[model samples]
Target chain A: MTDRDTTPAIEFRGVVKRFGDNTVLDGLDFTVAKGDRVTLIGPSGSGKTTILRLLMTLEESNGGLILIDGEPYTHEMRGGKRVAVPEKRRRQVRRRVGMVFQQFNLFPNMSVLENIIEAPVHVLGLSTAQAVVRAEELLEQVGLADKRDARCTQLSGGQQQRVAIARALAMDPEILLLDEVTSALDPEIVADVLGVLREVAETTDITMLIVTHEMQFARDVSNRVLMFDHGRIIEEAEPEVIFTAPREERTQQFLSAVLGEDTADRS
Target chain B: MSDNLQTLGDALPRLGDAVLVTLQLTLGGAALAFVLALLLGFGSRSHRGAVRVPSRVVVEFFRGTSLIVQMFWLFYVLPVFGFRLESLACGVLALGLNYGAYGAEVVRGSINSVPAGQWEASTALNLGHVHRLRRVIFPQAWALMIPMFTNLLIQLLKGSALATYILLHDLNYFTEQLRRSTQDTFFSFTFGLLVYFAIAYLLTLVMNALEVRAKNRLGAGPTLREVLRIAPVPATAKAGAA
Candidate 1:
């Protein structure tokens, strides 16, 4: 493929989302190029998670369009009118992306292996044998091969989140959305989840959009960081520059309020 | 006492047939009710008013009217409108409609109890609405619905006795015949009550087993062997003990 084929993996054009009277995302515009690992950092209710949710199609945008690989997925402009993309076309576009949640929402009725294999076999149309083989490889990669037959509820929270990562990867998505993945983990177990994610970032070219509170993990995995506040990207820069020497006043204030508290708590 | 024994012996075969008929009504009605419960329950949650409103109407209609009156109308009133059904059909239809309405609420509530994250996870996987509900939501919801369904099953069994009013020769009708012949109201009613209790207890055991199995499948409940503590001794250990 030529450079023309290298369209940004994800693009938002004045995207707007609101819940009743409360607007979560307002006229937002951003882009994540192919193979970019971008982390979004903000305080709660600052709309970082809403960005991921809108991308995953779990929530609909009230206004604006979302494009996957430069094609409309959520709303399309046709004949000078905006209409919802048909369900079949939406599914095709959505298959290019996968998401992991804050709650590690593995299918509780399924075993760890089944959880990973389900979407691959059902959505991707892989045969059971093929899906199982891929699932086992993912389970091993996540360091949970022994727990394949175990129920999702039987696993620890960290183990469950790892399985969720494996489940998302099983679909072989081009873009992976992580919404506060480590926020719910115990501090001791948080490192294990981050370790798996770091490995994925090092080994793969998957476009990752991460929303996290783990500053160090963000610094390690992301090439770019976007600081969000009140549904807007307040600052964007390289991880080192953003973390070490943010230019914006709000960015400086937010970093001090967050990192200052982190240092104080640790001491 | 000899005369009483003779009378009892004569009624035993008819009672056996009536018990079979009672079981037929209970089982057939239960199957129909379960299907209707799933349909109306999921339909009630539809985003469209057309689907949701009709489901609400059916659930309310059956739940509001008495089961006995519905049975009477089916058997008696329907004949005037050039529609006639067998007594057994009438009983099963009435029981199915009435109890299905109640079971629909259970299905709806249990589904609602599933965490919202589960739905989001399914959607994130690109699962279609049908696949998401079938593979993800329903299995978890099924475990929650079991206890409520068990309660409804027992109620349905007791209500089947009302079939006697529609001239269907179920267990209750046979009991009345035995009472008239023996002229012993106490023994006749006591026998019927004992039989009903036995059937209900058996159903409870069945439903308990199902609940355990469903919960265990989700890795939530104790397995059968663990609950019963039926671990087998090793051959070597058994030999040493012997």
Candidate 2:
């Protein structure tokens, strides 16, 4: 591969994560190229969310380096030796990555506008006026322009999730990690948030790593799709192939379970 | 009875002076207690043993000892060690520090009530530790904390009555003097009770109003009673119409 194609926006090499005795992510290896849209599909505890979180530096891996833009996030190497990066430097690195939570973790104390503008004004050192302007633009982009001044508590779940997406966008992050942004919304509200994400995928140069149960949405929006089970990516394919004819039994079982074919019709 | 009334009339002016001293001590002690409690509550959460251990010791020492004993120690024992304090100052200091230990628990409880996710969000945003506390944590803490803090303040107010034993001319002292001079023990002491009740009642009203205002501003959910009241009224009305 050429050097241009070789480099990825996010690369996880032999990543291992454990919570006491239980291993959540075991030797996970994956790469997302610059501006690529990738979605991870897996069972509930299949470690899809952990991969996204590790990229965002929300959790540290017990083993291996997570690289963003060809640099280690949790550690730095000096003279071919591994050393933990200082806390201050890790914070700087984190500014380049933004995440939208499944729970739509907007600051309940703040209005939608302030939620979007907080990091820009404080962490990025943008003036209030500048942050406000950028926030308005992102709000419009997320289709929450009408609700920008509304308190987060006043918004519906989907609107709040859109505001969360706008908040991440306001950071102008090179990579955005989305962990099931629509999963919490009402069925009717899910589309609105997904619509904004679709627009983002098309218009921006930002690389995206998404973990979603919305198979159709993922298949449509993602350039590549990965299927994970038991802390490993059991299958990786182009979106069409992943949706149509996945290789692994585990991937097929996961897809079938989410599609509601495996269980009896309870409803 | 008329002779008793005349004696009461003469004692009223002296009681007035004592009541003024009581107000000064109560308000001063309450303010100092609130400030100290806030400091100690935050200090107890410190990662370093240097900060946390001392604060814990201070809180435990004051809370375990009787307030009156603390007052006596401040007045008597501390003087022997060269920390001489006037009667009024000693009363305020002892009351403030003693009630402060109690108030610290309220502060800690309120701080804990703030969602853990709020702290995680601050850390995720790259906010520095101090900025995170000041900008993100403290405002929410203030809102969650007001009701409990107000209760502590009322307790501090009532607790200040204990200062009468230290020779500070507070409301309780005034009432005692009035009863002794006037021979109207029932009326004099009852009036002092009313005064304290009024002060404490006024504080509750203010704090309740503040709780409402803070809930509205912070978008903290509706009170359980408000939900219950509204919930039942609509359901009962619909049932009656049916």
Candidate 3:
């Protein structure tokens, strides 16, 4: 806490991600404060999910620097040039972050408890007993205490997502990335998972970067909502202000299409 | 009948020794093949051209050439270059290299078959490359590899017959002896076929046991106890309960 004083949780400067000749993130810049619940709303291929992926170190930025908790994360400036950090360094820093994928991505080979405890026992070097105790606590938090012994394949998508949330929380990450976490769930099942996310947002001070289509859940959970268009922030404001009184035409058009409302004037 | 009995009795000692040699060659070659398969399998997937290109080339070479020629090169041809190796050594080396090349493809396919999500989930858990592969990736991949490995093991057993051609006496050698002495070609060849089938059946049983165990761990198949029935517990009942 002392070391992190006054430092932003995440800062991106001129970050670029290109796929062949097409650039997805064109020199994007943004900042997220510690403990801020920020929601990214955009059309498809707006590079919203790419931001979360980059911060999790799953995707590399072809250009620019990323800072995590005020420290250089993806890259560092060496002689006025951005150089990617060594993987070991990236790994060490990423231990402070966790992500929940849209697919749940739970290991089918592992039981629910195994999925939660694997990293703690092996990567973090926690004793099996210690890891199990923590995992049980997380399972309790996610409201799946009895499903710990169940195989991931046997569980419902909603239940699996709850377990995935527990698995990510078991690491005790300072920042959490939810990549359309409820998009893959069934309509009714989405509420059950969103309930879990809501509880976590209310309870923990952890910073959250969410990419979601659930506008209601986004409005409910996020402090700030960022509307992206073509790899840049076109508008950003409080959830109420952004959702109700967006300034950008692209944001209004996207919100109208996603929200199915007659808010935007096409003429 | 008398002649058959006499031939069986006369060949028993030599046949017993030959069986031992066959087991040794089978086990040794399989052991070497397992290691090479793993090395080349991971190496072929390596990002560096230095490792991947060479690994691919080696797999192609061993797989492309004939096993008989490999044995000849290691045993007879090498001697001319002053690199003399024992016939038994040559046989093991050739068998291992050939089958290992085939097994390497199995290894690569098994590893690749693990979903990309699994790899990302592993990375998210902050697992290092070796740790991730060992604890997460390999276990699932290993389950997929067992059936293929079982196939290779049996194939290697049959392939061991070629090993005998390089001046190393094995099961085929002893089986041939019974043929010449008894002048009962039908009985001798049938005896050899039966022995080989018996060995293959035993190997399949072992592999089936492994498959059952692996699948059981994933909660996807019949249990090991159900397959092996080592003790007489009720099939559906949990142990120590009834």
**What value does DockQ give for candidate 3?**
0.37
Over A1-267, each residue of candidate 1 has an lDDT whose tens digit, in order, gives 766468889999989989999998999999999999999998789899999999988888888889989999899899988789988999999999999999999998898999999999989999999999999999999999998888787788899999999999999999999999988888778889999999999999999999987888889999999999999999999999999999999999888887876663210
lDDT of 2 at B128: 82
> Best-fitting candidate, measured by DockQ?
1
- What tens digits encode model 3's per-residue C-alpha lDDT throughout A1-267? 775767889999899998788798999989999999999999989999999989988888899889988789989999997788999899889998999999988887788999999999888889999999999998998899998888776677889899999999999899999999988877777888898899999999999999998888899999999998888899999999988988888888898898895233211
lDDT of 3 by residue, B1-242 (tens): 69898879988998888888888888889999999999999999898999999999999999999988999999989999999998888888998999899889999999999988888888888889998898788888989999999999999999898877887779998888888898889899899999988888999999888987887776565579775766664543332111
DockQ, all models? 0.45, 0.31, 0.37
Best by lDDT: 1
As for model 3, its CA RMSD to the true structure in angstroms is 4.4
By the TM-score metric, which is better: model 1 or model 3? 1
lDDT of each: 0.90, 0.81, 0.88
Which residue pairs show backbone clashes in model 3? none
- From the highest lDDT down, the ranking of the candidates is 1, 3, 2
Candidate 2 docking category? acceptable
Give per-residue CA lDDT, model 1, range B59-126, as digits (tens).
Answer: 99999999999999999999999999999999999999999999999999999999999999998999
Q: Model 3, stretches more than 4 Å misplaced?
A: A1-4, A261-267, B79-84, B228-242
Task: Provide the interface RMSD of candidate 1 in angstroms, 1 decimal place.
Answer: 9.1
TM-score leaderboard ranking: 1, 3, 2
